[model samples]
Target: MRCTPPPERRDTAFALILTALFGACILLSIIIPSQICLARGGEAEEMNLSSDTALSKLTEGNESPAQEGIPVHVYITNNDNEKLDVSLFIDSELIDHKSISSGSDQKMDRYLLEKGRHTFKITWWDEDVKSSFEVEETRDITAETSVHLYTILNDKPEEYEITVNLVNENSRELEAFLYADGSFKKSKKVGKESSAELGKIKLKEGIHNLSVRWQDDDTKIEYEKTKKLMVKRD
Candidate 1:
């Protein structure tokens, strides 16, 4: 036969068991919630990192480049006594211009041109008479450049153009030198049976002298021709 413990000792053992059970329940509740929170936080951080990387790649894929050209300037003056309508062109492409009044000047500041030979043309007409005239010049530009043009409108023979008929019959290549009023204008090269261009210059209203000279060193042949041109103005 076994004897039972005293009442005080039995009650103390019961209290100890209850305390241990309560402690175990509290520990389980804290640990399980902490673990769940850690797992969810890690998943959220990974998802945010992936989104940022994709956004960075998409932004870097959509960039672009720069552009380039040559600078140019143009100055125009109207020398006549009437309102004139002017149209300008570069390489046969029309450029916009405003109508100029009598004895007025127009200045165009910065313009972009490509690096090559370009032709500049200006067409002007008298607003009252509707008579139109055109002048053009070509230049090979490697860098920055400037162009100056004058518009002249008159009824009389105020300006004259000098033309030379270059005839080459010799077997050897012949070159001719042109002179205006004893000043050298340009040189022309001519081949056998080919008509060559000698260029033209605007002459003021007067009696002008035009001459052409050519020399052949092999044949020792020197030749010169002179002509008098008269321009009349009203």
Candidate 2:
């Protein structure tokens, strides 16, 4: 018998090898698409988390809160539903402190302060689940308030009129009231449009308890100042 060349067997082997290669290429294409989708989804999630964190920090004011010298008993109200830390300062130095609840108003007793200008600093802290990872916001509330210096003097009893020269330390408007025998005798607005109340009150010959009250609408209390003078008939 003559040995044939086995051409059919050779052709069958070549076709099987080609089929395996095509199957491998299809599997690789499918896996590549799945990997690319996973990567994009992960990146999107990270970007969203970063954006949310940035917005939360920005909507809140500046971090690292502080303030300078402010007035004594100023009205402070917390309009948000968060705890607030309040610090009182005198000439940029920390002195007293307090905490206020949300949606509540309270007054500070600034009477402990000396006669000078001061500032108040307030800070808001985020309620942290972990104390180490907390954020804070600070704001400085200013008060140009100062003690009113006033003195009621006779100048000269013979002048027959009380001379009340008011020297206001602050830029705000000042008012003076003359009280005699428990009645408001006279009142005048002083400072800037500075005024003088002369020849308005006539004196009687006796030791009179003349009370001079100086007050400003910005302050909480009336500055009690008094003087006694004896009148002599000319």
Name the runs in model 2 displaced over 4 angstroms. Answer: 1-165, 192-195
Which is the leading candidate under TM-score?
1
Best by lDDT: 1
TM-scores, each model vs. reference: 0.41, 0.27
lDDT of 1 by residue, 1-234 (tens): 222222220001000000334334334333432121224533632112233443354347445554456887877788878777788888898886778877888874567888999888888876544577888989887998898888875754456665556656556667777777898888877775556666767777788787777787676677777768776654
Off by over 4 Å in 1: 1-42, 46-65, 155-234
- Each candidate: RMSD: 37.3, 36.2
Cα lDDT of model 1 overall?
A: 0.64
The TM-score obtained by model 1 is 0.41
| The 10-residue segment with the lowest total lDDT in model 2 | 9-18
